[model samples]
Target: MKNLILLHGALGHSSNFEPYESFLSQHFNVHKVLFHGHGGSEIPAAGLSIELYVEQLQQYLEQQELNDIYVFGYSMGGYVAMCHALQYPGKITSILTLATKLNWTIEGAAKEVKMLEPELIESKVPRYAAQLMTLHGENHWKQLLPAIATLMTRLAVKPLLTQTQYESLNLPVQMMVGDKDAMVSIDETLFATKNIPNANFAVLPDTKHPIEMARPELLIGLMKDFWKI
Candidate 1:
């Protein structure tokens, strides 16, 4: 059986993959990873950059003595997974991403924030604060804005991958985005998959950026099939 390493989106813990855990366990050994600062893991708040996250993932894999695993990442987790595959092409067998964003342009930033606003506005302040706490603990509310700001403002340092980088990947790569994903454009997702030499791109109908609620089974099935577990 294949070993599947699952990654969750920002501010989300490994439990986010709870629904698929049992099903995936039946087919493959599953490890639902908890990113630093989430799930009571000891990681700093400010060092939550993409590179840091990638390093943490590598360490985790080493500690667990894992190899030849398939990776399934959602949203921000997807970004990490893509970078991982790019950096360590030989380690990954197959990669699958759901609602992953590739490039970040000036216009893309506007659209990204615009899409997030509605969720922030409609959300209950305390509930949202609690969710932040889940990821950042006691200083959740106070640190939320700064953390988000850092993600937006500091993103320029991390340039988007070129077409050559994506096509250079030797393993199969698959990306899925919800048709109704307000946070990321379908065109953006399409553009990402296009350059990948061994890539399959799919759109889930009536789905959203936070696809946890829309179609968990579809996500699970895609991973299982792609990994052939």
Candidate 2:
């Protein structure tokens, strides 16, 4: 079986991939990574950043002694996976990213950061806030919100990956976005796909930004097809 690593989105934990793990394991050796400050992991002293997550991933790969691995990343995880591939070439054989926001602008990031307010989320989206608390810790979840906001703000100023870098990727890459995904635009995904020499793009119908809401059959089918397993 091939080795496959599943990476969750921002504010998400390794457990979020549980739903698909069993099915994926039947075809590949499935592994999950929890970024710093997520899934009950202690926040690094330097806090959350794309560079930190990429380094964490590199450490995980080295510790496991894994190579030529396949990666499936969702949202922010997708962004981190690409960065890791760029930093450590030949480690990842291929990458599949879903609903990842590729185009980050100051205005766009500011809007996203504003939504990370703990109080506002607690007041307006109590269920989501409660989910965050459950995923992280009851007390620590609030701290994570600000840290993630800072990360987004930094991305707006300087993204980890540039157009030339995308073009330089030597491995196969597939970028997928849901047609109904409001957070990630299809245009941006397509643009990135076009830049990559060996890349493909796909759009899922009746899909949204949240991975939990995605139809399992459709997602798994795409993965199987991509991997030819």
Candidate 3:
């Protein structure tokens, strides 16, 4: 079986991919990565950043002796996966990204960052706050929010991948977004797909921003079709 890595989004735990893992494991040697500061993992002293995550991913790949791996990344994880492919070409055979935000601008990031405020989340969406605490660890979830906000701010300032860089990618890529996704726009996803020489784009119907809201059967079917497995 081919190796497959499932990457979760920011503030997301590896366990979030559990719904899809069991089915995917039958076809591939599935692996789920938990970035630092997530899922009870220790936060780096320098905090969470795209560069850090990519480096960690490289280490994971090396340690596991994985080669020509296939990746399915959700949201921020998708961005990191692309960066990893760019930084270390040929390591990943192909990629499938869902709801991954491609256009990072100062204005847009600021708007998104506003929604990540811990205080606001606790006050306005206590249930979500509690869920995050449970997912990331009761004590660590608060710190993770700010760290992720900083990461987003930095990404807006200096995006890891450029249009030209996207065009230069050698591996096949499939960019996908939910029709109802509020965070990532279809326009941006299409733009990325057009730039990448060997890339395609798709929009899931009735899908929302949250992975938990995604239709697992639909996503699994799409993955199998895209990966041809």
Index of the highest-lDDT prediction: 3
**Model 1: residues with Cα > 4 Å off, grouped in runs:** 40-46, 110-127, 134-138
Give each model's whole-structure lDDT: 0.73, 0.91, 0.92
Query: For model 1, how does the per-residue alpha-carbon lDDT over 1-229 read when each residue is reduced to its tens digit?
Result: 7778998877667877888888888977888777765654554746466777788788888998888788888887888887887887688788888887677766665555443442463374666566656555665434444454456544544554657778787888888989998777888788878888888998888898764565777776776677665
- lDDT order of candidates, best first? 3, 2, 1
Per-model TM-score, in order, reads: 0.85, 0.98, 0.98
> Measured by TM-score, how close is model 3 to the native structure?
0.98
lDDT (tens digit, per residue) of candidate 2 on 1-229:
6789999999988887777888899888898998888867788788799999899999999999987699999999999999998999889999999999989999999999999999999999999999999999998999998999999999999987779989888899989999999899999999999999999889999999999899888988898888887
RMSD of 1: 3.0
Question: How far is 135's C-alpha from truth in model 2 (Å)?
Answer: 0.3
By how many angstroms RMSD does model 2 differ from the true structure?
Answer: 0.8
Error of 3 at 71 (Å): 0.3
Q: Where does candidate 1 have its weakest 10-residue lDDT segment? A: 113-122
